[model samples]
Target: MSTIEAHDLAAGYGRVQILHDVSLRAAAGEVTCVFGPNGCGKSTLLKAMVGAIRPWSGTVTLDGEDITSLASHETLRRGVALMPQNGGIFPELTVIENLRMGGYILKSRKDLNERIEELLDEFPRLRERRGVNAGSLSGGEQMMVAIARALLLRPQFLLFDEPSAGLSPKLVGDVLKRAAALAERGVGVVMIEQNIREAMQVADRMYVLAAGRNRFEGTPADISDDRELMHLYLGIGKREEGTT
Candidate 1:
């Protein structure tokens, strides 16, 4: 069964409509990448799914239950987590402190501590900088901390928005690799990314959004080979040599 599903979703900011009739589904243990040009409503869709933005019309479901109108905290409590495109970490806090904040939703201190230890072991960079302020870390390191923080909640569905933004190629690879690992461990991952190539590489399935609508849905192989589709849906024309 699908872990997260959105049906005929229409969301926007103020009176400006961003997403129109956007429908998508994310399955357990799979990475579903949503790609589009800037302002195409990819992030808006993520926000709506996580209840950060309420949909004007449609329903969002998690594990077969309708959660369309739920509050953000309620959605998080139901095992859905959103890692927004920015501002995920508390800069003044140490890495461990930031992680502790993530576990605030948990009532049992022992369970929280155990989860933190497991996450630290999984993300050694966070472990090494456990006591350092998150603001002191590089962009990539901060991203890692944000991800580790989200994992502390033991979320079943993870929503990521532009996780590769403002990072070196190496760090981008690292972040996407971690996302792939999360999907492997049975967490349904829905990622909205500007880096189409890298996102497609890690995704099991992909959706192309154009003008706030789903233009295409397929695997990486289909996206890579279809130049016309890429140009129409993603605004990515044929790449010349030595171009991004």
Candidate 2:
């Protein structure tokens, strides 16, 4: 099975460091969720993994092949793609135009058109709104476009940076479900999310970061069942007293 692994990764913006010895593993057909307090370096981790930012120390591998510090476009060519925060859509571009940009790596125009149609069929609402500007769509629709754009390359692994941000509760669930669906279709999904409750519903595994370091790594049940982790890191309410 295909996999992406980051080990002992440390990165920063200029002199301010963010990630510290953070490690994660995501495999094909599974959803790995990363979450934590603001400034915990969750976004930085994604950027490093996708090559949007260079890792100061450590290694990022695709199926045991070192791919650390490769350029973002190079990473995409290696079958890993990132859907940046807010879906990373161009507001003025029509939905179809945004999808076309996603396929910029493709050399054949016919293949690009076919892939667009396939994706449009996969996302029926996008077919209906193909000509409309992406900025005017609802948050959920924009997210769909972003995800579709990332899919244009037929990536083996997809990374999402806070895909559910600023979305309604219903839309949050919808987007997470989409992530889960992608995993079901054999695309590895690594997502950074703040919507804990919604994220837990779709995540196959979870990792928590604090102060740019790993605090917890386990399944959703492991987190919910651990009172200490819940109380200290997650801030989830209703913990039983004196439970270990």
TM-score of each: 0.93, 0.96
Error of 1 at 50 (Å): 0.9
Worst 10 residues of 2 by lDDT: 235-244
Model 1 TM-score is 0.93
- Please give the lDDT score at residue 44 for candidate 2: 95
Tens-place lDDT per residue, model 2, 159-211, is 99998899898888888898999999999999999888889899999999999
lDDT of 2 at 136: 98
Provide the lowest-lDDT 10-residue window in model 1.
235-244
Whole-model Cα lDDT of every candidate shown, in order? 0.89, 0.93
**Model 1 regions more than 4 Å off:** 235-244
lDDT of 1 by residue, 1-244 (tens): 5589999899999899999999999997999999888889998999999999999999999878999999899999998999988647899999999999999989999999999999999989889999999999999889988998988888999999888889899988888998999999999999988778788789999998989998888899988678888776666666631274
How many residue pairs clash (N, CA or C atoms closer than 3 angstroms) in each of the candidate models, in the order given? 0, 0
Give the winner by lDDT: 2
* Candidate 2 off by > 4 Å: 239-244
